[model samples]
Target: MISFRPVDVDSDAEMEMLHRWVTHPKAAFWLMQDFDVEQVREEYRRISEHPHHEAFLGLVDGNPAFLAERYDPGHVELVGLYEPEDGDVGMHFLCAPTDTPVHGFTRTVITAVLAWIFADPDALRVVVEPDVRNTAVHALNAAVGFRVVGPIAKPEKQALLSVCTWHDFQSATSALPRLGASL
Candidate 1:
């Protein structure tokens, strides 16, 4: 089973791992290709300290397997860009880079991340604004029941604004294959 723990400034080693993952060519959409470990650490440290945002480390059998961030869309990522609902939460996730591929690993990771988000009792919907060019993530978002609202231009990049309600997620995943993970 997988679990999530809050990210904190003490996680230097995990920060290094994330630095590598985000800098990988496959992760170009992360937009941190040139970030060094210190830069990555400082960036996440800021997130960890922010009141409206949070970072989490996804653990698979106690080993860090991925990263997930959740934020108040009205306060942070989507502020002034989209009309955020009262319980809308913004999300970002990154699975660690690996040379060895596991069939359905990314899908499983995303499932875990979504389950984690929806677990919050106050959460009414999940919001995402992945880079417009990130087709892979677009498909993943759709599989998780996200419906594209439109494109929005942000300071960093053009992004596809998408949202998923709890009912939508339930409907989408109910018919799909189940992946095991507690998140």
Candidate 2:
């Protein structure tokens, strides 16, 4: 089963693993490509201390599979990054590096992440701003019910802003098959 739990980024081993994941070539769009070990540690330290954001390490059958964060866009991610609307909560996820692409793994990870975010009573919508060229992630986001709003140009890259409201998400995905369950 895929699950998410609060992570203790203060742990040395966890920090090391996170550093490797963020710096991996496949994670290039994550924007930490040139990060050093110390920088990674410091970044986690900041996240751990931030009040508006919560970080979780996603696990599948006790194996680390991804990193996820849930935060208020008005406070952290979309502070000066985008024009945020009320009830907007930003989401970020990074899948761990793997040589073999596991079928349905990304879908499961995204579903698990969205489930966790919407679990909060105050969360009305989930917003994501991924690189416009990241077609893989755009497809995954759509699978979870997010629809594109428009594109925004950032200093680092052009991003496609997308949102999935609680009601829309519920309606769109209600009949969709989950990765592990038999259709």
Candidate 3:
């Protein structure tokens, strides 16, 4: 089963693991390619204390599998960038990089993260603004029923703004096998 625990400041070791994942070439859009462990920890430290944002470590069968971040788009990352809906939440995730990647692992991680978000009764929609050049995530987002609203220019990159409602996610994933089946 997939579970999540809030990320904390003392999580240095876990931060190291996260550091490696984000610095990998496959995670270019994550924009932490040059960050060291301490930098990562400090970054999360700020996130842990932020009222509008929180981060979690995703565990699959009790082993850390990925990092998931949830935020209030209206107050945090997307503030003034998009029209805010009452129940909208923003999300970001990074799956652990592996030498022997399991087929469908990344998809499973994203599905689990989406499931976790919608589990919150207040979450009516999930928002994402991934770097426009990240084609892999654009495809994944589409597969999971995220519709691009348009492009938005952020300080660091030009991003494709996407949104997914609970109904859309359910309809899209219903036609497929269960998310965790591949793992």
Candidate 4:
């Protein structure tokens, strides 16, 4: 079984682990595949300091296995991309590269992410802007309730802007665990 818990991304040790995950080829969609350890550290450092953004390390039973980010779309990633709703939140996630891929691990990670985000009392909807080329993620986003609003050109890459309301997620994931369940 897989279990996920969130921890702050403040220590050098945590940054080091995240650097490896973000720079790996599997994280190319993350657009940090060319970054060195220090670059990764610096980038996340900025995120941590930003008032509207945050980064978290996801541990699978105490070992880092994924990264998740939450941000205010209105103030940060999508300032002009779309109209900002009162309770809209932006999100991004990356699964750490592994030699042995666990079946449903990625799905589990996404479900946990959505559940965690929606758990926030002020949050009413979640937004995502994954690279348009990332079809695998598109499918995963769909599975978790993200409804595409079509492609939009960002400074970095073409993104498929999508959103999911609380109802959308709840309706789409009716068969999944309620919350606080292990993967």
**What TM-score would each prediction reach against the true structure?**
0.94, 0.89, 0.95, 0.92
Query: What's the C-alpha lDDT at position 161 in model 4?
Result: 96
Mind giving the per-residue lDDT tens digits that candidate 4 earns over 1-183? Answer: 334444345577877788888888888899988887788888887888899998877766667778888999999999998988999999998998999999998988888888888888799999999999999999999998889888988999999999999999988899987656232
TM-score of 2: 0.89
The segments of candidate 1 whose C-alpha lies over 4 angstroms from its true place after superposition are 176-183
- TM-score winner between 1 and 4, please give it: 1
TM-score of candidate 4 versus the correct structure, residues matched by position: 0.92
> In candidate 2, residue 117 scores what lDDT?
75
User: Model 2 Cα displacement at 44 (Å)?
Assistant: 1.2
Top-down TM-score ranking: 3, 1, 4, 2
Model 4: which ten-residue window has the lowest total lDDT? Answer: 1-10
Provide backbone clash counts, one per model. 0, 0, 0, 0
lDDT of candidate model 1 versus the reference: 0.88
RMSD of each: 1.5, 3.3, 2.5, 2.4
- lDDT at 156, model 4: 96
Worst 10 residues of 1 by lDDT: 174-183
- Tens digits of per-residue lDDT for model 3 on 1-183? 888888766866777788888899888889999898988888899999999999888888988888889999999888888899999999999998888999988888888888878888999999999999999999999999899999998889999999999999999888766643111
**What Cα-based lDDT does every candidate model obtain?**
0.88, 0.83, 0.88, 0.85
